[model samples]
Target chain A: MVNREFTVENDPRILFGKRLAKIRKELGWTQEGLAIESGIARSYLSGIERGKRNIALINIYKLAQTLKIPVKELVDI
Target chain B: MVNREFTVENDPRILFGKRLAKIRKELGWTQEGLAIESGIARSYLSGIERGKRNIALINIYKLAQTLKIPVKELVDI
Candidate 1:
């Protein structure tokens, strides 16, 4: 039997997700709304915010632009 | 007994660490050299490159300046 890893607990991806969620909430935007503004798929946005995926670099800038935040804020260094 | 987390495998902090290490190596900088140039501690520079610490935002900018790279390149996001 093989044990597979499936959780994102304490992942740095969670940091990005948390930042994304926080910015979206601050803007009074839903996941779908942010997706539309970012020109990314809603499902992908949801996955990103849930820390289910390691988002690409380009997407990070797009999301930051849509959220009206600096890229550094989202990255948190 | 408490199970303290002791690993940073797949941590996004590792991403920053890796980028820092890469940049430093490209410039042929030793950890001590980078610390001297960035005005940070050598031990701290080692720790940051090892992904053993979550660096502060200001320090990130300092490291970027020392490396002569854009902050976005270090972020990869």
Candidate 2:
């Protein structure tokens, strides 16, 4: 069943979100700070953190740049 | 100026595209092979390689999986 198959670890989106949140917190930046620096909306960033949204390649570059890391680091799970 | 600034090396999309192409060729895989393996459209993969279209997070995951690499390796440029 669909419900049975849904899991945080099994879903790549959720895994990516968790990694993003962890890295952001590790860097001591708030969601607002990241949003402002990346020029992405705070709501969208929030959604991304919560695994509710998917971001594009440009955003991957922006987030990595804002976070001062490579895109690979940002996408690494 | 924006026109002067958009060099191949300076553009993250183009850099990423070049890297993708190199990695694909290193693995002896064609664009069509990647598309069919990843369930992504061949045209879209072509666009990504040409830096004409931006792909989302899920697509990144799919591409990495199809290419048999870590997401970080796939995105690294």
* Native-to-model Cα distance after best TM-score fit, residue A32 in candidate 1, in Å: 0.9
lDDT of 2 by residue, A1-77 (tens): 13333377756677788889999999999999999988899999998988877677788788888999888888887
What are the RMSDs of all candidates, in order? 13.0, 3.3
Clash pairs, candidate 1, are none
lDDT measured at residue B63 in model 1 versus the true structure, 0 to 100: 74
Write the residue-wise lDDT of candidate 1 on B8-76 in tens digits. 553545656887898889989888888998889999888788766667544665677788876666776
Per lDDT, the best of the predicted structures is 2
DockQ top scorer: 2
Query: Listing candidates in order, what is each one's chain A TM-score?
Result: 0.82, 0.86
Chain B in candidate 1 has what TM-score? 0.81
Provide the overall lDDT of each model, using Cα atoms, as 2-decimal numbers: 0.70, 0.82
Estimate candidate 1's alpha-carbon lDDT, on a 0 to 1 scale.
Answer: 0.70
C-alpha positional error of residue A24 in candidate 2 after TM-score superposition, expressed in Å = 0.7
Worst 10 residues of 1 chain B by lDDT: B1-10
